[model samples]
Target: MSSQFELLTTRRFLPFFLTQALGAFNDNIFKNSLMLLMAFTAASNLPMSTDILMNLAAGLFILPFFLFSASAGELADNMEKSRIIRWVKLAEILLMSFAAIAFYYELYMVLLGLLFLMGTQSAFFGPVKYAILPSLVNEEELIGANALVEMGTFVAILLGTIGAGLLMGLEQTLFAVSCVLVGTSIAGYLSARKVPAVPMENEAKPYKWQPVRQTKQAMRICFEQRPIYLSILAISWFWFLGAGYLTQFPNFAKNSLGGDSSVVTVLLCAFTIGVAVGSMLCERLSGHKIELGIVPIGSIGLTVFGIDLYFATPANVGDQILAAGAFFEQAYAWRVLIDLSLIGIFGGFFIVPLYALLQQRAKPQERARVISANNIFNALFMVGSAFSGIVLLGVMELSIPEYFLVLAVFNAVVAVYVYSQMPEFVLRFVIWMLGHSMYRVTHEDLNNIPDEGAALIVCNHVSYVDAMLLAGACRRPIRFVMDEGIFKNPALGWLFKLAKTIPICAKAKNEETFENAFKQIKAELDDGNVVCIFPEGKLTRSGDINPFKKGVERILEETPVPVVPMAIQGLWGSFFSHHGSGIFKSGKRFWSKVKIVASEPVAATSANAEMLQDKVQQLRGEYQ
Candidate 1:
């Protein structure tokens, strides 16, 4: 049977997607039109000069992120998100109004003012725009939603950039620009109106005038979660690295590919599509959790492809390269396109999860504040990216692909450092690798697994490979509550520890170990992590099954959330089950496979010792 992608079909995503796409298109259209006007036509006609005005326009646009982003984030939290978006869109309309007037009257200063106002609108809208997703999307849908947003934005920008370039290059560029702005503004306003209202989370927080002071306080609170800080740094640094490449790609195409702006467009398209593909696939790749393994893989791609592009590229393929169309004919040029596209693809895989992770994991009360803090770092990195680009390409005179090589190596080095410090990323990486390498397993009704706030997985005891199989199928990384003896097995010890597996023993089995194990599992689930335990507490030596223990209920009394019953199927004779030697003493390294049947989720109330065992036995009936 085919699956309908529910996330993409939802109303919550569609309206916002269109609104953002229109806004991006509008921004690029006007910005590109203005660039053409000032660079060629306006400059030629001006009595004094146009470069100063152009520079002022650029500064005006970016300045709002620094001034208004913090306030915007707070506003989104304090008021309805959809309403705030509407107001932001209204402001965009007003900004475009001013632009229309400026274009008609030839008022350059007025145009610059509109640009500044545009920046202001974007600033206030930025935080709410990204931070609102966790509330709107299911945890599993985050990756898909984010990917769509990004992809749509890029598509709009690409189209707008091309449209603006063509129309603005005409003799009556201002009128063409004015027409584009008016249409885009109209489209934006209509889309914003269609957006459904989502109520504010923070209803009572005081809104005061001390923006700087409040921002600092918010930043202080956000960094309290160290992993959050690391994530911020990683994300910010990506923008920094990406900004250089983005800014330079046009020049790189012109200089190396011996092509014009059309090649630049192709490069942009490839990269954008790559990101779109990457972002959309993130939901599937990471299995709906924030899998940091992809970050390493992305980093590696950034470095490796970057280096390859440098070597594969021959300098000055032609002294005077023809238009962009001819470059495609060269097989060598295709490499650059593929490289950029993959870089973007990997970049999406790296970024989307981290963004979702921040939203889902950050304290709900301070979510907007954390988002604002992220904005601060983002602004810093983007600004820094401008300088980095200049330093690497201009001052150092490094070739374009060589810059790519440098960025790639830098990504690898930084990734290693980040993963080493917080081993969760590396741990997830190991799990990701193992799961992919293991037999293909289709996980359905995984929502049959709880999202958070404590959960115990009760599964029938099958074989040595039961936990591994179950862990692979689960969306969340489960802390397997296992017997100490099995945990201490030399062969799988590393895997267990990496999974953060907690080992428990019965008082009769090992008192100190049991107490320690209970304490650890209790703490883990209490903090809203998934904990899995086999009620049998050991592999069934008998071909049938083993009796249940009250240990599950005992743990639930301390940290109760949801108990999910999982059934291991088809493991009876797959080399590890009791069908042959029937014990761990047998040294049979056998390649075999089986299916895991995940039963419907059970509440802690229904998970008494007897009921839980009966439920699993039923699910495991024929397979076991």
Candidate 2:
């Protein structure tokens, strides 16, 4: 129930948040203002067509990210970030001065150049901004921190876009932009001054200046960690999809919806607001962890809503400008707006975790380079998006709505591929669903589980889903030892396999399998991972804890790992549990409250199965 906004009150998070938001706001103001200027005022005087100019502006802005992100990443990794951020903000102020001169002189070419310069500044700032989060906030605060940052970013983008449009037609438009840009840059610089110093992991490392060499080096560093590599890919794909959506908004509004420029604002506002809402909700939904389950859910919504938007397109949109109010009058317009909003909402769900995951998992020394690699891919994806749009809409002659349909199907394919490559994503989705939908799960004394080192976790099994739920509750990865029969069940066999749940058979039923299970448990423990087992060796059939089995003693005799007793409560009557006639045949309980509580670890030398069961029993309380 704690507010993610509380982070804004803290010294570690607030300054960086303001600096990042201000930079994003300034970038959008310049970018959006130029786009507006070229389309309306400068088109007649310019040699290039408005379309070409607009696309050129966008490409120019993103080009530096491709060329310099790797170098930026290297710099961030080798030097202190607070210093880097301050310099970047100062560079922004200088660039805005040039932008002001260019705008005042009506020098379109100079303005375009300044746009790329702004992009270069952002490219250098990107890696340090993201890579600093892990050092600034504790693990428990990461999701909340990311949520606030992501939300602040979108809100800034929204405001910047709106501000650009409002100021473009004003009497001293260039003067106003000059003042605003310089003001935000100064504000951002002031914030950077307050950013707490985050030490560089590698201060002696030499910076690489060659773009190709640095990019290849960064890629090499990224590939050294599989999860980080995949997360970067997923994040890049999001940018690709986002670029497609955002770039098409103007045409979709004007041509497809037969509306004026104002309608585009309405559509964008809906999407931006939706993303803000979804980003803020992540902290609450994730229970303050880097929950990957929300990624799949977000991707699903993005694809579904994207497809629906194609269908939601009004069939008879005529060549007439509709006011914002009028645009919402049509039923399908409402549907279209809703689809856009949901897509943005799901987008937030998809993106925040990937960034958090990359930060949490990447090597400390190379984290900024990993983020730099991410930015490089993001640029590539955005460029690829432009090409894809051209091919689909130009060569194929697909309507904007039809392009949305194509992109939607492509999103589903990309998601399936990513999830297939990383089963952890899908498994987390299952756990998240079980925790959020099937039950209102709560954790108590979860911190009792050691952050690292081997621990033997013994829990009273209450349902077929208990292991999955427990995996979700505990912060560290748990190696659960489940009955072999349940492991082979067709409904959940593959899931259990993906989860790497250890399957154990009774010694009487299969001595070899049971012995092998013990060996695997010891191996996992030796690897310093948590190994969990049901002390009763099976789920309680009567909603009560069964007598503890002797297997716990045998395992302890070999490994002597710390034994942590945990209790699963309020799952006895759930569909997965042996409730009433049997399991899986009865109506399911929705949002049932389930509690998983862990007792402090007991020394393996003195702990016994019976005593651990008593601890679990007491933790279970009235539920069992």
On lDDT, the candidate that comes out on top is: 2
TM per candidate: 0.89, 0.96
Candidate 2 local lDDT, 5-62, one digit each (tens): 8889999889999999999999999999989899988889898899888888998999
Residue by residue across 200-281, what tens digits does model 1's lDDT show? 6766566675678767766786679988888888888778777767777777888777878788888888887887777777
Query: Any idea how many clashes model 1 has?
Result: 1
* Model 1: residue 91 alpha-carbon error in angstroms: 0.8
State how far residue 55 of model 1 sits from its true place (Å). 5.2
Clashes of each: 1, 0
- lDDT score of model 2? 0.90
Minimal lDDT window, size 10, model 1: 1-10
